[model samples]
Structure formats: C-alpha cells, structure tokens
Target chain A: MKILILGAGGMIGRKLTAALLRKGDLSGQAIQSMTLADVVKTDAPASAIPLHTVAADLSAPGVAAELIAERPDVVFHLAAIVSGEAEADFEKGYRINLDGTRELFEAVRRVHGADGYRPRVVFTSSVAVFGQPLPPVVPETQVLAPLSSYGTQKAIGELLLADYSRRGFMDGIGIRLPTIVIRPGQPNKAASGFFSGILREPLAGLPATLPVGDDVRHWFASPRRAVEFVLRAAEVDTSGLGVRRTLDMPGLSATVGEAIEALRRAAGDEAVALIRREPDPAVQRIIESWPEAFDPQRARALGFEADASFDEIIRRHLEDEAPATTVRS
Target chain B: MKILILGAGGMIGRKLTAALLRKGDLSGQAIQSMTLADVVKTDAPASAIPLHTVAADLSAPGVAAELIAERPDVVFHLAAIVSGEAEADFEKGYRINLDGTRELFEAVRRVHGADGYRPRVVFTSSVAVFGQPLPPVVPETQVLAPLSSYGTQKAIGELLLADYSRRGFMDGIGIRLPTIVIRPGQPNKAASGFFSGILREPLAGLPATLPVGDDVRHWFASPRRAVEFVLRAAEVDTSGLGVRRTLDMPGLSATVGEAIEALRRAAGDEAVALIRREPDPAVQRIIESWPEAFDPQRARALGFEADASFDEIIRRHLEDEAPATTVRS
Candidate 1:
C-alpha cells in the first residue's frame, strides 16, 4: 500500500512515518512507497524502503489537487496550526486549517468523480474541538462548542469529513487525539506543551517551569499509542460507524501530581528535582478550561488501546526514545 | 429602515413579508423600501410601501455580493432547499445553503472592513439541525447531530455566522425554527411536510393522508410565531450569546393523536374525519428519528414566545385562516 502523510514534519507525523517505515508493513498490507509533504522539509526515515519528501504550502491555490494527483491509496492528514498560533493569526489559521482541509477533500471528490477511485483518509483532529463550562466527563453526545479559532476549525473539518464520507466520495475517519505526553524536541506554540515539556526536560537533568498547579488534570496518551490509534482507525471495520464521522481516541487521565510521581518512579529523584513550579495566569486559564477526562466508549469498542497509567506512558517514551537514560538512585 | 429578504417566494418568506408590510413600519424605524429576492419571482406586497422584487438565482457567483451591496440595515436570510430536496442533490444544497450564506456574510464582512458598516443579520435555521435518538427533551447544549444533508448545511452556516459575528464584521443571530404548523401552501419536497399538511388540508374540508402513526411526535410553532421569533432575534441583546451561536426557539411539542384532538376541538369532528392514516415506513423512519421536543430555555429567556398549547395553536389557525367556515353541530 502506497501512503501519503501531510504535515509530515510535525512531531506525530514524523513518528507515524518512522513507525510505518520500520514495520515495513501494515496488517500484512505491503508498504510499497511513502510520500511525506509539509511546509517545512521532513527528515526521511532510516530504512531501505522508498521515501519521497516535498516541502510545499498546501493553502496555495491548486496545491491540494496537485498533492492528490499522485493517487496514494492511504492518506494521513495531520496538518494544522497549533492552538496559540491559530488564536494569534485568525486569518492564517482559517486559511490553513479549514480551507486547506476542505480543498483537500474537494480534490479527493474531484478525483473520484472523474473515476471511481476512493482512498482511505485518516484525519488527526484534537480534543481542542471542545470548549469549557462543559460536563466533567464529555460524552460523544456533547455538542461541539469551541471557544477558540483552532477548535472551531477542527470541528468544521470533522463536519466536512462526515459529509464527504456520507456522500461516498471517500472512506474517511477522524480521530480526536489527546495531548501526547513526553513530547520530544523543542517546545512548540501550544500552551499545553508544558504538560509534556516539564517531564521531558526534567528527565534530561534540565530544570523546567510548571505553568499549572499540581491538581490540574488532563487526558494524555503517549506518541506510540497515538500512532497505534491512527493505524487502528485506518484498518478498523467502519461499517458500524454511522453518521457521526469522528471518534475520540482512548487515553489516561492524570493530574499534574500524578505526572510528577510517574516521572520520579521512572527516572528517580534527580530527574524529578529538575522541575520548578511557576504558574502563569494565562497558561492557568487555558489549563483550567480543558477537559480532565472523556468517556471514549465508541473508540474503545472499536479496538484502540493506551497506557493505563502515566508511569507506563513515561516508561514507554524512555524505552522508545532516550534509551540511554537510567534511574539515578 | 430599508430591509432585504432573501427567499421571499417561499411559504414563511411570503407570510413574513406580508406581516412586515402590514406593520407599515418596523418598530419605530420608518420603512423607506423593501427588497425581496428569491430563486423565483416574489409577489410585490399589495401595500403602498416601496417594494423592489428581483427574480435571480442566488447560487450564481457574484449574486450574493450584488444583493448585499444595496446596503440594507436589516437582512433576513431565509433561503434554503428543503430537507428532501437537499438530500437528493448534495452539491446544490452545499452551494445554496452553505456557500451561499457564506458568500453573503463575506460580502458584508468586506463592506464592514472597508468602512464601519455593520447590519443586523437574522438567519432562519431549523430544528432539523438536531438528529434522532435524542432525549425526550433536547437541551440547547445537545450536540448538533443532523441526520439529513440539509440540516448539516444549516449547522455549518450557523458556525460561519457565529465566527463572522465574533470577528465584529456583522451583527448576527441564528434562530432555529421548529416545524411551522398550518403552513399555508401547496405540498413541497420536505419529508416532514405532512406534519403541517395533515392539519391544514383537513381544516379546508379537503382530504389528507398521514403517512405516519398517531404516536409520532414533533415540535412545532405557527408561521406567524416563526416570523415573530425572527424579528425578535434581530433586536435581542446578543452580548451574552458567547460562542453558542444558534438559539433554539420556543415551540409546542405534540403527538399526532394530540394534533388530531386539537383539530377536532377547533374545527369539530367532521374536519378530523377527513384525515386518513396509512403507515409509511419510509416516513415513519424519518419521523421516529426526529426530536420530539426542545428545551428552548435560552430562547424563552430572550423573550421569544410560542403558542400556549396545541389546541390554542389550532384555534389561531382557524381564526386567522379559515374564518368563512360555518359551525357544524
């Protein structure tokens, strides 16, 4: 199966690409070729498998159609502006997030209209599609009431996905992802980055500022689990997914204190001591508004799994990524 | 006040236009002119008020901008393809309901961006935006799970309106109208038309066939009441609206048996006897999936009112529409 990954330079996109390349196949489906496209250049995976990378802005006119012309059987759409960036630049956010996604769907429709060629599309949505003043545990039946431009754009994308799928132009599944903990590399523009950054930096013996309180709770899944959810969504039997086109992926809900304890258990006192608590009101407001947990029965019933505890998530991150790290007793 | 009414040829549009003309002026605002446009030609009001009637297809490119360029202080957007028609033609539904509304909003936005011009836009949405398997009383917070293409398009339109309003480009409100009862006109394409037709035809001493069972329940508001909701939505204080853009208007919820009983009370048993019931599984499936009632607390708090009971609603129809009928003891 040939596959294309949009926004391939992003953290999750890069991890997903590497996983697919290293596995060399998906559920016995042979991986023939992979195309990675993003606004920034993407690093090619270290594999003998054929890899093609392209750096192009998708919001430009005709870019969507041009990208789909390659006719990949599977497409992973992960492109989006982060929450803070979207709020800061409203026009650019809508241009890239909403219009870009719609244009891509239109391109797929046009291709299928010309010839009955329907491709499987896996779109990575976010929990940000929800807003605050909500129930403690949001159910699938809860209406989408986004408070920011980023969330609004994601909700609109989900609507478009559902409509296109209902029309039978393309086989699509939108996975609403949780915050990926122990996110590797430099901190991005998302306000929620500190949730992962605090642990990642502390494990590296570097001090990290905690912008939220110890009691602040949030839902999380490791990067490995995120990739697994995406893959399972692509391979699952969609016959049961009625008109509600998107599914909320399963994740572990943990408080900041729990996260600290998990880090201590995984990497000992030295790593835990590298953390400093300094709350910023701006970040606090954002954190307080996010959902602490979700009852994702729909996605769970569909065969997606995640770590049961924050410690397991951190351990998995250390095992897959910084393997040289050991507990300093 | 110069007013522009899109879709002035339809049932509610005609009634609203006539009511506005009857007032001779809107509130304390003097009526300088009224422009009416639709996919087909609209009848000029018999009043002495200056009327400009245009018969142009709004879905055509550039038409929306052309219509908005007239600079009307009040714009009533009531245009849409019915549920059945929209389901039959997906492209046309998106073009007219979704894209057409956006074009008008964008045009107004450009006008506002150029100068400090903002107009009160009253968009008529529908209860169809809510899908089936709902609680007996759906709250305003219920997720907008639309079953039909038309409802999805309306939901999208509501999103766009809220975003545009938040940007300070236009002052807008979306009124989610319940199914209009005693809809005075020929039967059209809506699958739920029998909800109104079954009552209206029998009152006129004409034969009417109900495709669903007596237990089928639906939410309803009279045509006059629907117009009133639209007019009130325009003047209501929208500061508290936040991001919950659409307001579910207050309405009466009645089962088909209750509806028949109300008809008997208002027009006697003879009128009710003209009704024949034959179960249509196709329409029954549609009706069974619709929302039985809406907890329109938001709308009521904003001062929108509906008929006290189904009986009162039926009586109003008889008093206003079928006045010439003699009483049969």
Candidate 2:
C-alpha cells in the first residue's frame, strides 16, 4: 500500500513517517511506497522500500492537484502553522491552514470526479478547536468554540472534511489530538510547547522553566501514541463515524506537579531539580483557558490508547532516545 | 441615530426600517441618516432621514470600509446568500458570508484602533449553524456541527464577532434566528421557505404546495418577531453574554399538520384548502437533517419572546396583513 504524509518535516510527522517505514504490514496490506511533502524537503529514511520526497508550498493554487496526481490510497495531512504564529498573522494562518486544506480536498475531489478515485484521508486536528466556557472534561459532543484563529481554521477544516466525505469524494477521519507531551525536538511557536518543554528539557539535564503554576492540569498523550492514533484511524472501518466527523483521541490527564514527580522517578532527582518554577501570568491565562481533560469514550471504543501512567510516558521517551540507559532515581 | 442596514432589500431589513421609522420616539435620538446596501438598491421607506443607497456587493474588498466610513451608530448587518445558493456556489458563499463578515469586522476594528469608535454590530445568524447528531432539544451548550457550507460560514462569523467583541474592538451580538415562518414575500431559494410559503400563499388566496411530510418538525418565528429579536439584540445589555458568543432565539415548534390547522383557524378552511400536499423526498431529507426544536433558555432569560403556539403565530401574521378578518371556520 502507498501512503503520502504532508508536513513530514515536523516532529510528529517525522516520527509518523518513521513508524510507517518500520512497519512491515498495515491492515494486512504489505507496505510498499511512501511519499513525504512539506515546504522544506523531507529527509528520507535508509530503508529498502521506495520513498519519494517532494518540497512544495501547498498554498499555491495548483500544488494540491499536482500532489494528488500520485493518487495514494492514504493521505496523512498534518500541515499547519503553530497557534502563536497563527494568532499573530491572521492572513497567513487562513491562507495555509484553511485555504491550503481546502485546496487539497478539492484536488482529491477533482481526481475522484474524473475517474472515481477516493482515498482515506487522516487529518490531524487539535484540541484548540475547543475554547472557554468549557466543561472540565470535554466530550465529543462539545460544540467547537475556538477563541484563536488557529482553532477557528482547524474547526473549519473539520467542516470541509465532513462535507467532502459525505459527498463521497473521499473517506475522511479527523483526529483531535491532545497536547503531545515529551515532544522530542526544539520547541515551536505553539503556546502549549512549554508544557512539553518543561518536562523534556529538565529530563535532558537542561534548565527548563515552567510558565504556569504546578496545579495547572492538562490533557496530553505521548508523541508515539499520537502517531499510533493517526495510523489506527487510517486503518479503522469508518462506517461507524456516521456523520459526526471528528473524534477526540484518548489521552492521559496530569498536572505539572504530577509530571515532575514522574520525571523524578523515571529520570533522576537531579533531572527533576533542573526544572525552574517561574510563573508568567500571561501564559498561565492562556493555559488556564484550555480544557483540563477530555472524555474520549468514542475514541477509546474505537481502540485508541494512551500511556498507562506518566512514568510509562517518560520511560518510553528515554527508551526511544537512550535505549542503553537504565537510570535509577 | 444614523442606521446602516446591510442587505436592506431582505424581508426583515425592509420591515425593521419601517418599524424604526414608524416609531416617533427613538430615545430622543432622531434617525438622522440611513445607508442602505445590497446586491440591488433597496426601495427604502419614504422618510425625511437622508437616505444613501449603494448597490455595492459586500463580497468585494474595500466595500466594508466604505460602509463603516458612513459612521452609523447602529449597523444592522443582515447580508448573506441563502443555504441553497451557498451550497451550490461554495466560493461565493465563503466570499460573502465569511470573508465579507471578516472585512466588515476588520473595518470596524480599524476605525476603532484609532480613537475607540465602537459601533453596535447586530449580525443575523441562523439555526442552519446547528446540524445532525443533535439532542431532541438543543441547548446553548450543544456544540455547533454544521453539515453545510452556509452553516459553517455563519458559525465562523459568530466566532469573529465574539473575538472582536472580547477584544473591545466593537460591541456585537449574534442572534441565531429560527426560520421566519409566514415570511411576507415570494418564495426564495431557502429550503425552509416552503414552511412559510405553505401558510402565506394560502392566506393570500393562492395555491401553496407542501414539499415535505406533515411529520417534519421545525422551529418557527414570525418575521415580526424576527425584527423584534434583532432590535432587542441591538439595544439589550450584552455584558451577560460570555465567551459562548451566539444565542439561539426563542421560537415555537410545530409540525406541518399543526401549522395547517393554525392556518385554518386564522384564515378559514377555504385558505387551508388552497394548500396542496406534494411530497418531495429530496426536500424531506434536507428537513429531516435539521433539529426539530431548540431549548433556547439563554435567549428567554435575556428577554426574547416567541409565539405561544402556531395559532398565535398565524393570528399575528393575519392581524398584520389582513386586520379586518371577521370569519373563523
């Protein structure tokens, strides 16, 4: 089976591509070809399977059509500007996140319109779609009340996906991923990045500053689990989706204090001590506006899973990065 | 008080202007100016208020700025293409509904940026913004999952309004109006128009056809009530409206049979007999997709009232149109 991954240069995108490359079988279909595309040229893995890299700006009118000409059986779309950048530059955010996604959907529709080519589309949406006046644990039934332009754009994308899928242009699944913890890389412009950075940097023996109070709880999942959700979503029988469109993915709920405790247990006390407590009210206000937890019953029923505990999450991160190490707290 | 009414040619727009003009007391503020705009120049009421008519399409760039430059204290933005038209022409729908609203909001923000000139922006949203997987009665808390482009565009407008208002750029309120039953005009492209046409045409001594089944239920408010809702929204204290931006206006819920019975009670069995029953399954599917009723508790508490029953609604329409009616069959 051939698969195409957009935004393959990003952290989750890169990990997802690697996981797909490593997998010998996906839903009983032997993995054959993989194509990766982003604004920057994506690096190919040293694998026996054929891999194609395409660097193209999807916001350009005809780029979507050109990309869809390949006609892969599955399309993983993860391209979007970070929340901070999106909020700062409204025009660019809509241009890329909204219009770009629309163009891509149109490309697939046009291809299907020509000779009935329908591909499974897995769109990585975000929890940003849900904003203030939120219940403690948001359900799939919660209405999208996005305060930020990024969230609004993502919500709009979900609408497009639902309409397109209903019209038989393509089978689509929108996965509203929780904030990914232990994100393995330099921090991006996303305001939520600090949530991961506080834990990740401290574990790496670097001083990391916590922007909010220790009591600020948030919903999160490991990067590995997030990629798994996307892949499983692509393979699952979507007939049960039944016009609801997006599904909130299963995740773990933890406060900054809990995360620190996990870090102390998994990495050493020294690593935990590296975390500096610095509360910025501006960041705290933004963090406070976010949903503290989610009731992903539908996603769980559909077989999406997350880390059993914060320790397991941190352990997985260490194991993935430094496989030879056996650190004792 | 100067008033700028976008979509001045529309049903509620014409009625609202007439109502305002008829009111002798406007809180000691006389109607000094009226700027009317639509795709076509509206034939406004004959009043001493200096009237300026513009046939300028709001979708065109720079038009919103021009409209805002008129400096109307009260801006009634009711401009939009209907659902059927929006669904048919996706680009035009977004252009007018989404981009046009954004441009207008930005224009207000720009004007307010230099010297805080906040005008009261009253946007007319619709129940089309709510789609299927709805509860028996949708509450204020229910998530907006619009199945149509028109719905998505309107929801986007609501988001924009809330953000702009929260930022103190402009004072705005979005009222999700129920389907205006017994709309005093010819049938338009709206799928829900048949609800009004079946009653209005019959009352006017013309043959009216029912497109859907008697079992189909929908929310209803008279055009008079709709105007009142808009006016109330404009002058009402909006400090109570928190981040959950839009409010679903209170309305009566009735089936086709119920509506016909009310029509018969108001305009005699002769008018009721003018109704022809013809089931269009295509239209039925569309009607079925809509929510049967809404629990507009928030709107009720905010002082918006509705017809007691379909009977009251029909009576109101008859009283407004044919006041001297003496026979009840």
Candidate 3:
C-alpha cells in the first residue's frame, strides 16, 4: 500500500510516520512506498521502504493536484494552522484551513473522475468546533456553533467531507480530536499550550507557568492516542456513519487540580512544585467558554478508546519522551 | 432606508416586495430606493418608492461587487436552486449557493473595510439543514446533518454567515425557513411541490397527485409568514443572538392526512375527490428523511408565531391566492 501524509513535519505527523514505519503494514497489507509533504522540507526517514518528501503549500493553486499525482492508496490530511494563529490571520486561516482542504478533495475527485481510483482520506478536526453553553458531557448529536474562526473552518470542513463522501466523489472520514495533553515539544504561544507546558516542563525539571486556576476542566487525550485514532479512522468501515461522517473521539476529562495531583504521583512534590500559578484573566476567560467534556458515544461504539485517567496520560508522556529515565523511579 | 433583494423574481420575493411597498418603510426609516436582482429580468413594482431591477447571475465574478456598489442598507438574500435541481447538478449548486453567497459576504466585507458601511444581511436558510432519525419536535440546538445537496449548501451558507457576522464584517441573521406551503405560480418539478400542489390544485378546481402517504408529517410556514419572518429577522435587536446567528423559524407541523382533512373542510367532498394517491417510492424515500416537527422555543420566545392549525393555513392560502372567490360559505 502506498501512503501519503500531509503536514508531515509536525510532531504528530513525525510520530505517525514513525508508527507507520514500525508497523510496516496496515491490517496485513504490505507497505510499498510513502510520501510526506509539508510547508518545510522533511528529511527521508531511515527505512528500506522508498520514501519521498516534498515541501509544498497545499493552499497554493495546483499544489494539491501535484502532491496527489502518484495516487496514494490512503491520504492522512492533518494539516492546519493552530487556533491562535488562525484567529489572528483571518484570510490565512480560511485560505489554508478551508480552501486548502477543498483543493485536496477536488484533486482526489478529479483523480476518480479520470480513472476509477478511490483512496480513503482521513481528516483531522478539533474539539474547538464546539463552543460555549456546552453540556457537562456534550452528546454526539449536539449542534456545532463554533465561537472561533478556527472552529468555524473545521465545522465547514466536516460538512464538506460528508457531502463529498455522499456524492461518491471520494472516501472521506473526519475525526474531531480532543485537546492533546502532554504534547511532546517546546511550548509555543497557543492559549492551550499551557495544558502540555505544565506537564512537559515539570517532567524535565523546568518550571512552567500556569495561566488558569486548578478548577479549569477540559477534554483531552494523549498525542499517542490521537495518532492511533487517526490510523484507526482510516481503516474503519464507515457505512454506518450515515449522513454525518464526522466522529468526535473519546478522551480523558479532568480538571487542572486532577492533572497536578497526577503529576505529583508520578514525579513527587518536586514536579508539582515546578508549576507556578500565575493567573491570567485573558486565558481563563477563553478556556471558560470551551467544552469541558463530551459523551462521544458514537466514537466509543465504533471501538475508539481514551486514556483511563490523567495519571495514565502523564505516564505515557514519560514513556514516549524520555524512556531512559523513568519519572516514577 | 435603501433596500436590495437578490431574488426579486421568485414568488416570495414578489410578495416581500409588495409587503415592503405596503409598509413604505422599515422600522422608522424611510425607503429612499430599492434594487431587485435575479437571474432573469425583474419587472419594477408600481410603488411610489424608487425601484431599480438588475438581471444578472450573482455567482459570476465581479457581479456581487457590482451589486454592492450602490451599498443598500438592508440586503435580503433569498436566492438558491431548489433541492431537485441542486441534486441533479452538483457544480451549479455549489457555485450558485455556496460560492455566490461567499462572494456576497466578501463584497460586503470589502465595503465595510473601505468605509464604515455595515448592512443588515438577512440570509434565507432552510430546515433541510436537519435530516432523519429526528426528534418529535427538533430543538433550536439540533445539529445540522443535511441529506440533500441543497441542504448541504444552505448549511454551509449558515456557517459562513455566522462567521462573517462574528468578525464584524456585516450585521447578519440567518432564518432557517420551514417548507413554504401554498407556493404560488406554476408547479415545477420539486419533490416537495406536492405539499403545496395537493392543496393549491384542488382550490383551483384541478386534480393533484399525492406521492407520499397521508401519515407523513412535516413542518411548514405560509409564504406570507415566511416573508414576515424575514422582515422581523431584519429589524430585531440581534444583540441577544450572540455568535450563533441562525434561527429556526416557528411553523405549523401537521400530517399530510391533517392537511387533506383541512382541505376537505374548506372545499367539501367534491374537491377532496380531486386528490389522486399515486405512490412514488423515490419521492416517499426522500420525504421520509425530512424533519417532521420543531420546538422552535428560541423563535417563539423572540416573538415569532406559528400558524394555529391546518385550517388557518388553508384559509390563508385561499385569502392570499384568490380572496374574491370563497372556498367555504
């Protein structure tokens, strides 16, 4: 099977690439080749499988068609500008997040129109699609009234995916991932960056700033689990998804206090003390309007799973990031 | 206040034009001028108010910009291809319904950017945004999972309208109109045309076909009430609407059997016998997935009223279509 991964330079993309390489096959189908495309240049991973890496902006005219010229069997579309960046750059967000995805879908449709080639396209959406006035555990059937521009773009993408799939233009599946906890990387400027920052920093003996109170609860799954969801979504039978093709993946729901307690259990008082509570009203106000938890009944029924607890999430971060020195020991 | 109607040639558009002319003003503002645009030429009404009609395709490049050149204070966008036509032609649907609307919004944004010109953009959405396995009375917060291509386009338009409004590009409101009953003029090939035809034809002393079973229920508002909803949506204090700008307009929900019974009462047994039960599986299958009823709590609370009963609906159809001849003693 020939596979293609867009946004292949990001952390999740890199991990997904490594995971695919380790598996060598999907559901016993032999891997023949792989193509990775991103805005920045990506180096070919060390593997016997022939790998092609390309740096291209998917939003640019003809770029998506060019990328799909080889007609890969499965395409993982994980490319997107983060919430903060998308909100700040309105034109850029609609251009890259909305128009870019449409171009890719159009490209795939043209391929099928020319020759009978139907490749599965797995799209990565975000929890940002749901905004204020959320139920404690938002049901799968709740309305999508995204307060943010980024969320609106994702919601639009989900609708497009469903319509395109229904028309038999292409095989498409959208998975709305929860906030990814313990993201293994250097913290950027995202408001939700603190969710991962406090954990990743303290695990490495670095102090991290806390912008919100401990009572701030959120829905989250580990980056590792997120990648798993994407892979599973690609292979799952979607005949039962009905007209609504998007699925909200299950995730661990916990408060900041619970996460702090979990960190203490893993690395003792030292790691817990490293988190400095510096309140910022701006961040608190933004997080306050976000969905706290989700029922995700549809995803669970479809065999998707979430982390058991915040403790498990912290432990997974240690195992994936720095396995040489165990946090507990 | 100056006004612009994008689909001035359609039935509801003609009624709205008459309604506006009757009122002679919107709120307390005086009507200075009006621009009516449609795919075909629109005849000027015999109103004292200055009226200009433009015949052009809004989807064509530069057409939207040209339409906005005069900068009408209130823009009523009620233009779209019907469900049957949209389903048969996918590209045209997306082009006219989706891209055309986006271009309109973009044009409005550019107008705002150039100067301090903010217009009230009242967009017409449809209950087709909701699909099957629906609740008895769908609530305001129900998710949009349109089964048809037309519904998909309308849903997309709603999302864009909300996003544009949120960004302060234009003051906007999207009213998800119920299926318009007793639609005037010659019958076209719409699947839902039977809903109106079953009543309209008999009133005109002609035979009509019933493609679906009598037990099939659906939501509806008369062309008059729909026009009222649009006018109300235009003037209401939208400060309470927040970011979720679209609203489900209240309407009468009755079974096809109930509608027929009302027809019997209005026109007696002789007119009722004019009905022919001709089951078309294709039409039945399509109507089966449509929404039956709606709670419309939000709209009711905001002062929107539904027709009291099917009797009132039938009487209104008669009054609006032919007031000189009485159907009942």
Error of 3 at A6 (Å): 1.3
Off by over 4 Å in 3: none
DockQ of each: 0.63, 0.53, 0.78
Supply fnat for every model shown: 0.52, 0.55, 0.69
Winner on DockQ (2 vs 3): 3
Instruction: Note the residue pairs that clash in candidate 2.
Output: A143-B143
Model 3, B216-273: lDDT tens digits are: 9999999889999988887887888887889999998899999999999999887889
> Which parts of model 2 have CA positions greater than 4 angstroms off?
A24-33, A187-191, A211-214, B24-29, B106-118, B167-169, B187-190, B205-216, B269-285, B326-329
Better of 1 and 3 by lDDT: 3
Score chain A of each prediction against the true chain A by TM-score and list the results. 0.96, 0.97, 0.98
Q: Specify the poorest-scoring 10-residue window by lDDT in model 3 chain A.
A: A320-329
| TM-scores for every predicted model | 0.94, 0.90, 0.98
Computed on alpha carbons, the lDDT of every model, listed in order, comes to: 0.84, 0.84, 0.89
Candidate 1 contains a number of clashing pairs equal to: 2
* Tens digit per residue, CA lDDT, model 1, B1-329: 88999999887788888878877666568788999999987779777889999886677888877888888888899998878788888888888888788789878987887887798899999887777559999988887768877888888888777777877888889999988887776766567888777788887888888999998888999877988898787678888888877899999988999999888877788989888888889989988888888898888999999888877777667766775463333
lDDT of 3: 0.89
Candidate 3 is scored at a TM of: 0.98
